[model samples]
Target: MRLRRSPAAVAAAVAALVVALAGTLTGCGTGERAAADGGNERFTLRIGVIGSGNRLTGPVGYLHDRNALVPLLAEAGVADITVHTFPNGPDLNQALVAGELDLATYGDTPALVARGAGQPTRLIAQAQVGMDAGIVAKKQGGPRSLQELAGRRIATQTGSYMHRYLLGALSDAKVTPKEIVHIYSSDVEAALERGDVDAAAVPAANVEALRAKGYPVIDSLAEDHPAYRGTSATVVTDAFLEARPGFVKVWQAAQVEATRRAKANWDDYLSFAVKVGGFPPEIVRRTTLAEQLPDTPFTEEGLTLLEGTKRFLVEQGFVRRDFAIDDWIAPGARG
Candidate 1:
């Protein structure tokens, strides 16, 4: 599908331009100085995530729901924590660029887009890797394969990892759609039922439920297109890292703990995912197990996947420019 910029997209471009200019004037040296001067300051860490309300899925959500992050963050002098949710990653990026969110945990696409647009953020962790996207077709008269999608309308949440997967998968299949509509995840089912679109690219977590409801799965990033699989990125603004110099180490420790607990108590973690993610238990189990959470903040495999994601975004023109993933990663992130 050809890319079109809506009014919201134009506004985002303007915001990105402003951020880029600001970064050019101030540079990284100021942030480094702040880090050295304010190593022990206490503050409230505001985090933006992609989800419904304040609920999230996976290991991060597990820790938040269990109230496990507070103590770990306390070690870094974080007095409080606030979580804000956006419908998609681009919205979360807007919050990050606006300085409303000190940290963000979301899909890799928008995070890379933000970084490429000169948003001062650091990659602190790969919360999950090898995430999958699914393409689901209508129950009746739906396309049977990716090739059948040509000349047909497709729908997906814009700026989502699923959106990236849809574009890549279609490109690989050498299929061009009639149109690609931007729909929210909550509205995808209704749109499909109304025949508003031929097929929809959805998160893997929703594929099983949709299939149970009679939607046909045409293609999946996990099974059919592993190269286009998504990853969840945990990023913090350079300003935030500067102000709380020890934050990355503490946050990494918290992530390690979360991953450990999630694996150790698998059933309890599944129950927690079902409660907060609002997906069926079976779907949650299948999807959660597929998301490979790292014991460390960053793994070699995860970083390689992240680098590939950034490369794809840049090549596809989703990101404005290219950047080295190594330079974007924060100190202490690998641990």
Candidate 2:
């Protein structure tokens, strides 16, 4: 049965919602909030992101960050919400450790690295997962299969997601990094182009771009290993959660709504991304953002990936010890 409210009651409810959001926007659950005359403390949220100049750093991310619902933060009694952007994962992790950023978003592997190193952060939500990632070879080298170039050189950015993906993909094919000439290259594509490396693991977009230029894709990481699926997440500090529980809900709800809207209206979302993110329309059309947001904020499937990533990092000696996945995943954080 459909329930309806009286006009006066509806107006009152709208007014209350506006008041709550107004308060939240004004303060946003920031530092050292004071109790008001009614004995209530304000909430301030301080948000941080990694790097600038990418699609995420520009208009696309902005539309998601500040939208029609964003203003509701002020109504929710939050006074100050500040956003800070760092150049990379390490820098963003540093900001979190120093108590500068209340929330952050980054790849799954890096988050595992941070937690394994004893950083006090928890995965609150997932930003993206299940991307098309793979390894590519220059056309001239013509390495078509994992076994074909057993002794050839491979290139990948050390300690990055692609690095982890390559390691796992090779292991699945019973290939060892030692068997291949491992060359550390700052530029994977450049290394492949110059014939300095036989193959390099990269995102699906890069793979397609390279293949279009006549590069051979030996293996797709996402296709071969379900565990290697993309998983970008949103993290929060314990301190922030303790101070403002309501604001946490607000933030999560906003992200959830954004993801839902983006999915339901995909072409429109991509258009927004291209126009605002500064990405070429062609690139946006070629690459898929259909899996941009996971159905749940965080899922058992994703946490399993986290476990795999942590184990891989520890085994690779990238981190000293492996952290229990449960330690960093706060209960009830996922919706």
Candidate 3:
């Protein structure tokens, strides 16, 4: 999940940019270019990805390392591309705002935050769908219903898409956030294990990990219900698209290929994910790969789900206002 960066993070990104730029101009630092030098075209598409610390990010980084992305990107005239990983939402958003990333995949919240903050960003594509979210507990097993959590402590990251999921879950049960003790993300899972928190919101992989140790899940966001479906996607800066139209088309095509492979050869992809991404085979098997629309179109139905999410956040005061859906989506998206 992504959110607006704190001013401090923004400042740090700016400082880093300044230092990097100075190094490049003075030829003092290790400033490398991602281009095939026939001494002509320099095509580098720098992108922000989730930090290396996360298990999910490993396979994607490997895809790049093994040069799988090179030939694909080359088709789009992006002969050289760099994928930058940040540890958290704030830093990732900060890098995007600072023009560090041409495109990236993130949760709905951060895309809205970037648009709301007047960054020239747009939701251009989808990376995945379907939530892997669930609720876990250590004592008395998992709650059978949301009502069981009355006055119980729950942990989740504030300003996260999971936070929206948690709020939606509470609303589904006619409960309010005020009714539960809210804890931060860093400590949520641990708190649940130690009995400091009664329940914690967890993504699918973590759920599998925790379940191995006997933590029972009370509820899950991965319900078959239509309302709980749909998750994260890709977003890009308008400036980047303007600068490299050829690259954008190729990048989208590459994602389409990946999605096709994911759907058609689920078992193989999962195995590849385990081998390359370092995700355990069990976790890969348990984690749902997002469904692609028939035409693979980023449609109004998709936008509607995101719009509803934004409205939920606004209603809950997570964001200041409800943004026009068109403002966040790209032009010609329906086409």
Candidate 4:
């Protein structure tokens, strides 16, 4: 679903792309497509992700668990599909700006940031909203409460929804972004281990790992604080959505199927979670059981969260331009 290539390879491929391939992508309603008349359209749906392991209740995990993305994209006339992983949302946003990805599943913060910066991308669907997130720190000398982090260095992947949540978490305690140092989640764990950063905002997956390593978890949105909620979304380039009218619907179907499967077969879900989240079975069992984590659904709450995130990012100067969140959602694509 993302980057890197040789110039010759890029040019020859772009020169070779047929109108039929183009037709299918734009959902031009042009019928079976000219290229398909001879054979199937040659198309690749590139996806971007922010995880080394596909976990949590998002597109990456659902696709990984069911092996459903390829066949689903194929049904929509795509032949090749790639799922590219990035270290964080900011990195993924770079790929999107360079036009390296056709679609990306990332938090609302990065997606909004990309859009605010003039990336021609549209929110196709909500992957998740209100995912469990929290701040964890080294137990040895870490702060006991959010207030203690006021004058300390706290880290999170920069430009992430979690970063926004960290800002809000601090704001709730009357703390400001200037009070904490921002670092990447990739390096933050090491920083915490070295006692360099006093605390970090992490996904539910890592909270247990840090706690197990004797880090104290100062706060977790698992209890569902308004701004602390996580919002992961399915975004496609504006060009991609224009070409495939109901492409987002197909993706949504895969989400529904994946969620149903996880709920129906919990033991399997736990096994997948353990591997992806890098937590022990007991922790995965307790932390991410079906009851603890809700399935990702497009709803009023998700829309509310999306709107709030956009406004917050602009207010904080995280995104330079202001954009209507609704303008970013694809035509007929639900929240």
Candidate 5:
């Protein structure tokens, strides 16, 4: 006593069942998305770095160029990655303030400045430690030593690590300059050549090149004053951290992996540095050798350096307000 349905009726029934199953699957997908993203899905992760040519340098850049972070970030529900480069750290901080970047890796000086200025950013990692800064003067007629630069016009990119080094070294030597003009790092060479600046504070890698070109290196932070060496900071916006809770952990893992690969293939890393930094091979090798990339997000030595830098910035009035370094660091990053 069963009756068979018409062909059209059976077709309609099958279509309805298909729709029901699709709805169930989609509902599950939405639930998973909410759980992963804390109620909203963020598919893009924007990162800022301090460099030109829209290229990221160092171990992070090395891994990024190879797509090594793709799979690692996918675990955190990020499907797209974009990197923006700035000419200096202040520009990078501006992008962060404008809500244009989720994270940034740059000199510690600007990072502290932004934090002191009430920017809600967290220090997620210290990318490199013991970075050196140097001062190069005109060979023809320029100060031969840090003491000689007293009452002379000097140039450095304001709010940069080199700027911090210059101030600290000069203060320690009790020398006051006539002026410290704000010049972009890229234009420092030209300013020196034109005699626009008696000397310029630059990265250590540039010291050798300037010396070869007859520019005399008057002082180096690493050689003359190790206490003033800079460190690179990897920081995340508070909003992004809240949206993507798993990002910091994954990022640190990726950094460790990148460091491993870079060390194993040391020569390849040197080549990468030369290409990205536009420095000679020997300079790259020497500078790279001096930098210590932490296997963990935060090492004792790295944290110590960061604390010292923050204290110096505050004491020197570069940072108007002082904040606890511990509170600024993200959770689970101290290991």
Candidate 6:
């Protein structure tokens, strides 16, 4: 839950850049929200979760399982919590724009793309960073590098961090994107085992399952590539941010508290994830429980990673326009 900061000198420079980018975050607002209904008024906090459900490792997972946010939001007069799941980031962003979500958790690429497209939202905090994707192939024999996988059938969950990782890895190795086989995460191991695809770039949690089946693992984005290391953040639509500042702060505090509790009960938390995620317990324990979960105020490293993601999205035509990372984040958050 500790966020790594940039060196002081670099932080100072980036701080200046943030101040410059803050204003462009939202193109236009619908004007100020109407006054809240009285203290007794009950309102639901709608949250968009990217992925079927994490309910085990992230801030949302911790908060959701305990029904913690419901009480926390009560402090600010919000009464209920509703979590909606999306298979991927792009789909989640669509729901947000349609006014179905007030807050969301998703990868930086789709968030940036949504913001660049004029979605009035701000990244209030980060829940994950430096996550690595595993590239696994059939056990018999497989390519050693991304370059060798060129023109080969590569599998991944489309519109996920794994998808972006595969793209960045291939690009870094000077291999162009071509003939990718998109599939669900659960099917990755089967795809690799049966030679349905020469290789699959999947979330780390899925790697152990493949390895258990004797699939040969080739590379990890964390070890071999820095720029594409994955990240997921907590964001709030501008409408929510403007209408209930206290609610947002309370929500952020709940996330931090959830992180604290999750860290304290690490093993139990992993076990809980296994049930909610329907994956192998060992996979959840090894891949997510061992991985660091982050809390608010953001981090300098996250900003750098986000900048790289934005560049990649824009370059690949995923994002229709350019937007400043600083402006995309919560104005109050320093990172």
Deviation in angstroms for 286 in model 3? 2.2
lDDT of 4 by residue, 229-260 (tens): 76777888666565566577777776776767
By lDDT: ranked, best first: 1, 5, 6, 4, 2, 3
Candidate 6 lDDT score relative to the true structure: 0.68
Q: Global CA lDDT of candidate 1, please?
A: 0.79
Per-residue lDDT of model 5, residues 198-276, tens digit only: 9999987777778778888889889898887888899986666765667788888888888888888889888888989
Candidate 5: RMSD to truth: 17.3
Sort the predicted structures by TM-score, highest score first.
Answer: 1, 5, 6, 4, 3, 2
lDDT of each: 0.79, 0.61, 0.59, 0.66, 0.76, 0.68
Q: How accurate is candidate 5 locally (lDDT)?
A: 0.76
Best TM-score among the predictions, by candidate number:
1
The candidate maximizing lDDT is 1
User: Would you list the clashing residue pairs of candidate 3?
Assistant: none
Report clash pairs, candidate 1: none
lDDT of 3: 0.59
- List candidate 5 stretches off by more than 4 Å: 1-42
Point out where model 4 deviates above 4 Å: 1-42, 53-60, 63-66, 176-179, 289-297
lDDT of 6 by residue, 110-227 (tens): 6776676666688887778787778887665666666768767787876667777887777777775346866878877667767777888888878777778777778888878867
Clashes of each: 0, 36, 0, 7, 0, 0
| True lDDT of residue 141, candidate 5 | 82
**Residue-level lDDT tens digits of model 1 in 109-128:** 88887787777789998889
Cα lDDT for residue 79, candidate 3: 69
Q: RMSD per prediction, one decimal?
A: 3.2, 13.6, 5.8, 7.6, 17.3, 8.4
CA lDDT, candidate 1, residue 282: 80
